[model samples]
Target chain A: MSRRTTLLTALGWLALAAALLGLAPALLSDFRLGLLAKYCCYAIAAVGIGLAWGRGGMLVLGQGLYFGLGGYAMAMHLKLTDAGPGQVPDFMVLYAGGEMPVWWEPFRSPVVTLLAILLLPVLVATVLGAAIFKRRVKGAYFAILSQALTAAFAILLIGQVKTTGGFNGLNNFQSFFGYSLYDPVNKRMLYFLAAGVLLASVALMAQLHRSRFGELLVATRDAEERVRFLGHDPANVKLVAYVLAAVLASVGGALFVPVVGIISPEDVGVGASIALVAGVALGGRASLFGPALGALLVGYAETSLSESFPGSWSYFQGGLFVVVVLLLPGGLAQALSALASVRHRVGGPPGGRRRRERPASDRTRPGPTTPQEVTA
Target chain B: MSVPGRDYLEVRGIRVEFDGFVAVDGVDLTLLQGQVHFLIGPNGAGKTTLVDALTGLVRATGLASYDNQNLLDRPSHAIVRLGIGRTFQTATVFEELTVLQNLDIAGGVHRRARSLLRRRRGVPERVHETLATIGLTEQADRPAGVLSHGQKQWLEIGMLLVQDARVMLLDEPVAGMSAEERRETGELLHRIGQERTIVVIEHDMDFVRDFADVVTVMSAGRVLAHGTVEEIRADPEVQRVYLGHTVEGVA
Candidate 1:
């Protein structure tokens, strides 16, 4: 990019920061502000999806696993704080009264909760990613494996009525840390925190996208064999992106607990995980701003559509995903590229020509979600 | 780490058997540094398979050694890191990336992961120099995907240059080219071949005759002939199997 384009992009980011940080809080009501905070969490998760599936070419279908780890870690601390010093959570009293599970004890500390929210998801993702990438399992197989793992995670939470809250999961938080939930001022602070984190995540990814590592990530995606012959391990390159994705999802889920006042299996199951992916795909997986904006739009649409037609909301979500996949798999940018041919992207991918050396049959072998060449 | 005129890549008893079909049967070829070695033979004579075996792309039982490390059994990436590189029959530069970015990524194998996370401050001097070497300085900003076929092939060679490859295994580098492009590529091979070991798996007899310092001929998964271009062309045994057609084709 030229110096002039770089200056304009910096200015554009500053303007967006102003709108998101200053303008949004002043404009929306408390309820609406809280909703936006929720959407920001989803956006955080979407950025990770973009890094993994979009650039790294690893379909991270089980981001909910990381999200849940962070959400539950935060919720555990909040629930423990609500229960006082000696007692277990209220759910234990109703379901199977007993001592606090040894595993949940660590999350009682605010420091531990924070660490868990960051490390737990990364740890799990690294283990899972290492196994999958080492075996070179990818495309639809990876997607299915991730989805199945998340489904199993949801099922495990539902079955553990004594420890976890079972089907209801964790909910009814009275406070976040020492801050009272009822205080509107504190609620606004939470919103700013989420928004700020979302911005920082975007900035961090933008930096990575411009970095040598980012270029290598794209190289590995397009030509894994070619990349291997270049002397850099594609598996290791992909693992870094996958780990970053898990960390982002984990952080998003942690913030989600305070902002939404709940952490539940329903929020980190296959449905929720797919919803996060849908938002990214709807936005434009490869574009920097597209994922976050797409997630916000999808979240807003979900709220509006669900309010009007609560029962038909699932059908709408499914239909939206189908349309995005079948018609516009390139996501919102595919539509926008027509209007603003310059469709500005933070991590403007090296667009033009896929693996030309690859047999034509192999490009579409994995199905519609395959990384099609994006020239624009 | 290489001394000119000494053995660089020593391959002994390298055999590739795919379900009872022996593709590369007991091949022993010692590639020496500072030599433009050409491996020329009929199609399916295990030339490509031999390169694959040496590069660790195929699981072959053999002693393929470089820098005292057994090249076989290690991964393809490891083989590259050991100062060995191979290009496919077709150009395989990352089509989406710019020519500069392609070389940058290829060159970065020697850099630390920590350094890679930061934005590239400026084009590295080595990468910049390589653009001139490959004659793609003007096309550096253009995505490699848009380069002309000959240019793409040069970019692939440029990638090996950036990789600092001590041994370069090129597969039919000038298969389709204008006479001018072929000449340019032949010149490129000469420029880079001065310090490194180059093994060109070629079908173009004229290219082999013009460029090869030492030529090895293979037939039916075996070494049919080995020595200078003149010796192989003069031998009656070589004439019967291969050179009978090759000398005619070139004429």
Candidate 2:
């Protein structure tokens, strides 16, 4: 991109970060801040959905599996930590006769829990994605397979009630890395941490969108056969995007556990996975900021609407999603673009020249990669 | 067309069958380096099927080799990585991506890693050169879906150019092009053929006659004739099977 455009984009990102980091804390109460933190975690997962479904064209309907992986991983460590050094977790004592499952033993160490949070989802996605994509599974079949996986994962977690806390899930956390959760100061800190992580995730996505891998993933999405003819294994391109999305979802889940103080099948099921996708779709799946912002908007709307109309808020949310999708298939981003184009039309001929002349300068000139040229 | 014993591509006994019906049955072909070869046939003559078999897009039992490496049974993308590039009968540019981005992806496909941290430096010199070559430099920033049918065709061909494949397999490159576009594409193929072996599957007899260095005529899943364009034109069997109803009549 031209230096001016790059500066503008950077400034825009900074403005967003400043608003989130500075304005939010100064304005909101502790309860509201905590809610925003939970929303931020969902937004992080939505960003991953945008990458996989929006750009890579992989309808990852089973992100909950990875999300649950990270959430459960972190939850186990916290539960063990709460139970103290040599004792079984309280849930195990209450439900499983004070016997910790062998699998849960590894999460006793904080370092191991963190690493698992980072690596376990990526590993699962790699194995599953490689197998499915290499065999050339795609379209609705792939979507169904992913959805089924999420359903099965939720079922397995529910069925293992003695060890998994049944449908009640893991909760009642008292500390995070030694900071007592009861302190409002620590709660605010956790909110900042969540915001910071969301910002970092956005920055990471921006970097990937400009990278060659991002371009290849988009290309694969558009035409897998053509990409294959270009000497790229489309499966590999898709697998990378899938695995990246899994890691992002996993990280989001890890953060979710501490922020919400709960990890349950309800939060990691086909319904949750589709809800995540709905947020991305509403935000404009292909856009960088759209998914995150869309998710946050959805979360806000859900909470406020439910507070006002407790029983019927879900119908309102569903109706709004349906209307946005039907009226503007490209989501909020498409609506914004359409508005801009309309303004351009009304504003006169000068705006027209820019679009027309873009190809000449962009094609013939040797210059830096333009952000719009890459991502758009 | 003999220099020494070096063959650019060799195919032996390729056969493709689906549910007890043979599409491409027992075909052997050879391609020479830096030449324009055309494979022409009627609608159901298995010409595209043969290309599919050669490119590993279809299940085929045979021995096929490019640069002394066996190609049979390899995956389609693996075959492409072995320096074979192809275009579909239908124009298949990435519709959402711009013309330049489409070419850029094709150019960057062979790069060692599609890294997250490392941005592609710039549009490669070759990509820009290809835009000019295909006469689409002016439309490079436009989304490929907005391009006209003929423009999309040129863009796909431009993609092949940027891919830098040793062998280019173009399936119906000029199938739906206007007369002027076809003429331009013929010229483009002539220029491109100077560097790489090109196997063009075309229905346009005039294009084949005007531009082909070698013509392989297929009829019902087998080679009816394989010779220079003139030799194929002169052959009675090719005339009866493929060119019999032509106005020009293979004169």
Candidate 3:
């Protein structure tokens, strides 16, 4: 990109972020602001999905596994805090016969909970990614493996009702770091916090998208054997992206608990995970803003649709996805490109010859969620 | 055949089996440094399979060593790290990347760091030099996928050159090219042969006659003849079973 284009893009992103960050507090009610905060957390995870699936082509279908890991860790810490000093969590006392599981003891410390939130998901993803990528597992097979992982994870959590709160999951937190949750002021603060984190995640990914390693990740996705022949391990390149995606999902999950005041198996199951990917696909997996904005829109639409139709909102969501897949294959990004081209036709000479002459073969392949070219 | 005191690539008793059939059976080969060796055979003659085994892309029991280090049983990527690079029978450049980016990535692989923040460009001097050698300097910014088939082949060769692999295993580098493209590729190989050992698997006998320093002809999973172009041509068994009318017309 030219220096002028790069500068314009940066400024555009900054202005957009500032507008988004200011809108909720200025216009929305406390409840609506909190709901937007929940969507922001989901958008954070969607950004990671864009990187891993859209750029790396890993199709991470089990991000819920990492999200749940971070959510549960944060919930455990909060539950312990609500129980007060040296007391077992109320749910544990009531459900686990008044004895806190020895495992939950360390989470009483904020430090350990935060560390586990950051490290546990990454650790799990690294071990899983290494084993899978090393064996050259990819495509739909990888998708199945990840979906199975999320299913099994949900089942395990459900079975541990006493410790995990089972089907009900964990909720009803009174405070976050001793700030009263009942205070509307503190509630809005959480929304800003989530917005700030989401913005930061976008910036981090933008940097990564420009880096050499980022380019290597895209190359590995397009041609694994050629990447191997180039003297760099494709598996390692993929593993790094997978681990980063897992970390992002984990961070999103951690933030989710305080903002939404709920962390349940339903929120981290196969359906939920697929919903996350659907948002990315709907938005344009290759575009930088597509995943996050798509996720927020999906969340908003789901809430609004469900309010109107109650039980049949899922059908509308499914129909929207189908429309995007069949007509706008590049998701909303393609629509944006089409609009820009139409504008150019109305105002300018027919653009560059290379852009005009790109073959249909190039268009047939799936575009990477990033700005890389379509593979042949 | 073993050549004493030579310490480059050595292969002995290499065998590749699939189910109950043998693809490459009990093949022994040796290579010296900086020699351009060509492996030629008819269709299904196990030439490509032997290259796969040599590069650790397939499982085989054999003493495959390069620079006294065992290349056998090692993964393909590890073999590349051991100063051995390869190109596929069909060109396998990352179609999404530009020509310069392709050569840059290949050249930068060795210098890559594990740090997330370490930003660097592709190896500039080497990539520019390789682009000139392959005559794709003008198309440096074009995506590899947009190039013609023959240019893609040259780009793959450029990739191997940029990687600086001591031993380059090019599989059918000129399989689908015009006569002029084939001649250009032959000249490119001849030039590259000055600094590296290249084991090319090709069916083009004319290209082999023009560029091969040593020729190994195989038929039905066995080495039928191994010698210079004239020596292999004179071997009756190779002529009768493998080359037949093909060599007479080409030579």
Error of 2 at A309 (Å): 1.6
> Candidate 3, which segments miss by more than 4 Å at Cα?
A1-5, A350-376, B1-7, B115-123, B243-251
Q: Give a tens-digit lDDT track for model 3, residues B47-81.
A: 88888888878898878877677788788888888
lDDT of 3 at B197: 83
Candidate 3 lDDT, A39-59, residue by residue in tens = 999999999998998789888
C-alpha displacement of A169 in model 2, angstroms?
Answer: 0.8
Total clashing pairs for each candidate: 0, 2, 3
lDDT of 2 by residue, A76-163 (tens): 9999889899898888888889988798899989999999998998789999999999999987789899999999999999999889
Candidate 2 Cα errors over 4 Å, as ranges: A1-8, A350-376, B1-7, B114-117, B146-148, B243-251
DockQ of each: 0.54, 0.45, 0.51
In what order do the candidates fall by DockQ, top score first?
A: 1, 3, 2
Is candidate 1 or 2 superior in TM-score? 1
For candidate 3 chain A, the 10 contiguous residues with the lowest summed lDDT are A367-376
Question: Considering summed lDDT, which 10 consecutive residues are worst modelled in model 1 chain B?
Answer: B242-251
| Residue A270 miss distance in model 3 (angstroms) | 1.8
Q: Tell me, by DockQ, which candidate is best.
A: 1
